[model samples]
Target: MLTPVTDIDGAPFWEYAAQGELRVQACADCGELRFPPRPCCPHCQSFASEWRRMSGQGRVWSYSVPHPPLLPEYAARAPYNVVVVELADAPRIRLVGNLVRAAGDPLDSLDPRGVRIGQRVRVVFDPATGLPQWVLERA
Candidate 1:
């Protein structure tokens, strides 16, 4: 399980994630959606915001494998996969997360080399964090 750094703008997103729901900030004014929670909508610059639940479905917009483990905490889980997922519900927004338990093994294990672009993925949750993480959307 990965611990998130919570900020004023991002806390709500994590809270929702902990509840096994994927939520993004939607522009209360123009209806534009965004991730990485911000004070205002990037499209309309609206300060108003609300939570919109996602279908927990998306595609791998981009991905990479980190070599030699970037942090000591991850050394044990080396060669893990990190992905920038573009949600099917809102293409403009992408969520960055590790693709853990998508196939097998611990979620923290790093194996970025096995990932592919445009691959279908789905959300999975770790009970330890009570958050909606990600996994391969199996056929």
Candidate 2:
């Protein structure tokens, strides 16, 4: 797996994930949560920020499956579904991740045919990458 690019602003998110937690950046003053952690808050333009832990529960908002002419690096992971998950804690904050059948399952392990919009899912950290992956809440 490719190591995620991390910077001063986003490092905390990965650090939290390394410890089996899912967190998002929030404006310390406004208390608004944001993904893709950045130095300044978009809502209030505040440099003061913090990481907020999430419930890790969400609903599938949308999804996509790449077809023919797959990239060499992803050809083997073909037939996988990339889902946009709307966080239960912050409906406005959506995340992109693979919708797997179970925790630790390969990206392509879940049958795309079985995935449905609004399906409930929870976060699971990959042991190797510490990157959060999504699994059906009740697989």
Candidate 3:
């Protein structure tokens, strides 16, 4: 299992995901939210922070379908779609994840050709990875 490295600052994120919730670190002082959790707030340099729950609704800000020569773990899913989802509540907060068919599905479960910029998506917890993945919302 190639799980994400859970560092001191980012461990809570994975914890939340394991609980089936999407959360991001927010500056306790300025209420500014940030991803890839850090010790200090980038907005106000506040050392105080807290995890805030997210709506889990976002749009595909961008996407990419990787070609060959990928890392060994990803090579098997070479043609999978990776998407940057811009959170609806906090547009500035974008998260990268694989767009899959459903919760706990494989990364390459969705067809690459089906992904599109600006497509609506919703978060889903992948129990296998203990992470938040995405699934396209029905129109």
Best by lDDT: 3
Would you list the C-alpha lDDT of every candidate in the order shown? Answer: 0.79, 0.88, 0.91
- In candidate 2, stretches whose alpha carbon ends up further than 4 angstroms from where it belongs are none
- Give me the runs in candidate 3 sitting further than 4 Å from their true place: none
TM-score of 2: 0.94
The residue ranges of model 1 lying beyond 4 angstroms of the native Cα positions read 102-105, 108-113, 130-132
Q: What tens-digit string does per-residue lDDT give for candidate 1 at 1-139?
A: 4667899988998898777788888889999888778998888888999989999899999987766746777776676777899999999889887787643346455356668999898987666665555787879
**lDDT per residue (tens digit) for residues 1-139 in model 3:** 5587899999999999889999999999999999879999988899999999999999999999998898888889879998999999889999999999999888789999989999999999888888789998888
Which consecutive 10 residues in model 2 have the weakest lDDT in total? 99-108
lDDT of 2 by residue, 41-137 (tens): 9999999998889999999999998765787878888878999999999999999989886656788888888888999999998888887889989
Error of 1 at 86 (Å): 0.8
**Candidate 1: RMSD to truth:** 2.4
Candidate 3 structure, TM-score to reference: 0.94
* Ranked by lDDT, top first: 3, 2, 1
* lDDT against true structure, model 2: 0.88
Q: Which is the better candidate, 1 or 2, if ranked by TM-score?
A: 2
